[model samples]
Target: MHPENGLPENSPTTRVFVALAPPDPAKDELARALGPAYAAYPRMRWNRIEDWHLTLAFLGEQPVAAVDLLRAPLAELAASRAPLSFALTGGGHFDERVLWSGIEGDLEALQLLAEEVRALVREAGIAFPERRLRPHLTLARTRRDDPASVVEVAASLSGFAGTAWRAARLHLVASNFGRGPGPIRYRDVASWAFRDPAAGGHSR
Candidate 1:
């Protein structure tokens, strides 16, 4: 169990897996491409485009203190792995509620990154949620009446194709702040390079 954040040993804090995010232009392009669809479903709580990221894994809540122990190995993993190049293609919905854009290019690299992050988390004795990594950028969330709107949005962006972007670093972020009654904010507590310069290959 990790240490808790001054919460009388019972407050819930979410633990998640995060990776380096795409550049601003890439994210903005996706947002612009998705704007019309979002206009159609005003009720949906669309995630701000600035929050788009490529998640490598999702580690459930843990004692907050455990992060220090986990950071070293995670940094090493990042230093050993090479960067990845990818593009955005198409749009879809999750359980008819959450809307997202699909990712293309270098998917194999993404899978490898997920596996490495999972192994590192396990090595630190942290309990992680079991779920396959589905790499996609979340765009918006829907309400009960959102199914039809979601379908329409999905059909409209069926042919989206964005320019490719390269990923160079891995970031450990905090999501507790900027979530409500204000703009959402994500803080990167730590980050490391995608690969070791000497080896000319991604870390194993």
Candidate 2:
């Protein structure tokens, strides 16, 4: 089915995911930490700072109609949850192919949130493979010919620790990766701010 405007089955589908993005100041701090790696490993495919996010659930490709069904339920979920506090710390590589920054602080809360998001998608009848949650922010990727670069860069970021920030919103994002030429681009399809119970479920 078409995933764009939910016109019909002939319309294009979008790759979607649920996530939390760091604020500009938090992202800037991480950018500053990566300055040296950016210069040293110019060949690495670095993700754009604006695209940096901590994924809560990857919904894969879904029809626009199906994705639309998630909005109301997700909004209700967000309204029941409070903001989470977290910080970006250290770095790691996945099989020396993808470089990522680790997450710290309030991990238990983060896991619970991820679980709830996945449950909501499933309850909506969306079928996606279940995978364990490993919280990390993808930073860059290394080419097959130069596998060592990611390892070196990851080591350089061992002591890097970003400032704490409250994750206030849950975002439904659409990506066009591997669907066309040029770099992958991401845009928000929907978002909801966390509601504070003490404040009468009002989003701050």
Candidate 3:
């Protein structure tokens, strides 16, 4: 059994999630909109641009061996799905603790994709909580004492809208957070491109 959660302790484990990330240009557009927030809420914990992603399935703390079981199935799923078109638009907050940017366009397709992803994880024998899909990219978090900061910042982003972009890849990522005192870091364990027939069955 694992020392932390007692699932299985044969090998080390990492917290994992499957997600779709906005392209660099799209992320840059959102970053520009956040400039004022950055200055006003300097104490808030802002997520790095590179770490911003729309999580499809959160498979928290899985043994490395269990995580490896997901690779092939996820790749095949990605190969069958078409790219999704979406844009960053507006913003919101969750209980004034978290700040997030909302997503717009092709929402039906996005929901379908998320459902399929969660199904795939289940088929791989990975157990995770099932939560309703709320399409948003987490931007930052405010301290418990500074509740108003997120509310104000979210209001500032009310009218912000970014250019639409194709989400072409599905990323299986791992984060190192609780294991150490250093800043949390996210890295891809594997990624698969959406199959585009016009692009010769490859991602552009």
Error of 1 at 43 (Å): 2.0
Estimated TM-score per prediction? 0.83, 0.91, 0.90
Residue-level lDDT of model 2, residues 110-141, one tens digit each, is 89999999999999999876778899999988
Best by TM-score: 2
Total clashes in model 1, counting residue pairs 3 or more apart in sequence or in different chains = 9
**Backbone clash count for every predicted candidate, in the order shown:** 9, 1, 0
Each prediction's whole-model lDDT (CA): 0.73, 0.87, 0.87
Sorted by TM-score, highest first, which candidate order results?
Answer: 2, 3, 1
Superposing all C-alpha atoms, what RMSD in Å does each candidate have to the true structure?
4.2, 3.2, 4.7
Clashing pairs in 3: none
Encode model 3's per-residue lDDT on 1-204: one tens digit a residue: 344432334558878889999999999999999998898789998989999999898888887888878889999989988889999999999999999999998899888888989998999888988888899999988888999999999999999999999998999888875766544677788889989867565432
